[model samples]
Target: MSRRSLLSRAIRSNGEPIKITIDKSGANTSAINDYNDDAGADIEIRQNKYLNNIIGQDHRPIKQLCKATLGFGRFRTARITIGDFESMRIIRKR
Candidate 1:
């Protein structure tokens, strides 16, 4: 198989979304960093990698990647990232 196909298969094989916390400037900070300290361009690179994986996986819903559960009862629920769910003040859909 081609390298692209192999890489795509490898990313999909994980079966887990790499949880990422993106900063206001669109940098993907580390999950362990509560302060969201600026880590420079590496953060953006990591975030892009995770995003690429997600897209490569065909946007499959992976529970591990879900940072928030929204809505309840007759509402359209969704799983969101930690940063968006908390920092952005998004209410739970469920």
Candidate 2:
């Protein structure tokens, strides 16, 4: 890709961090109240501080997409991450 394209992509990604949650339960229910009612599980918003910078992405008042979606470059070169992994994937391409 050209340098201009790269800059545009980076600019579009305002470095907003989206919020994510982990459901320990293996079952998937359509109703959120039912899920909460199933068991009184503590609801805590996960804001991992370790994921501040990976590809020069800021975390303070992170950029958010909708409710839980983040944007980053497509210069990956490593194994995929699991849902449990809260850290953002940083890939530096040559």
Candidate 3:
């Protein structure tokens, strides 16, 4: 799918975002701008590599576990597996 449609679908599913931090991809920038114009919504876009590090850090452990398992065969199983992993992590932290 094209980047514009992909971005629009994401916003539709997740609801409109107030601000988005993205890499220096011109395609992504153009998509966001198009979405803003089409929807007549002002969504702030920040292009900063460092701003995305927190999201990357949070997903690191989950990615490592999935990599070791060679990935899940289905989306449902993956979602449940990751949900359980997160639940265990949260409980352990308490």
User: Which one is best on TM-score?
Assistant: 3
TM-score of 2: 0.20
Clashes of each: 7, 5, 0
Clashing residue pairs in candidate 3 (N, C-alpha, C atoms within 3 angstroms): none
Winner on TM-score between 1 and 3 is 3
Which residue runs does candidate 2 get wrong by more than 4 Å? Answer: 15-83, 87-94
Could you tell me the lDDT of residue 86 within candidate 2?
A: 31
- Root-mean-square deviation of each candidate, in angstroms? 15.3, 16.8, 1.6
Flag regions of model 1 displaced more than 4 Å.
Answer: 1-32, 35-45, 49-53, 60-73, 76-94
TM-score of 1: 0.18
Q: Which ten residues in a row have the lowest lDDT in candidate 2?
A: 77-86
Candidate 3, run of 10 with poorest lDDT: 53-62
Each candidate structure's TM-score, on Cα atoms with residue i matched to residue i, is 0.18, 0.20, 0.87
- lDDT for position 23 in model 3: 83
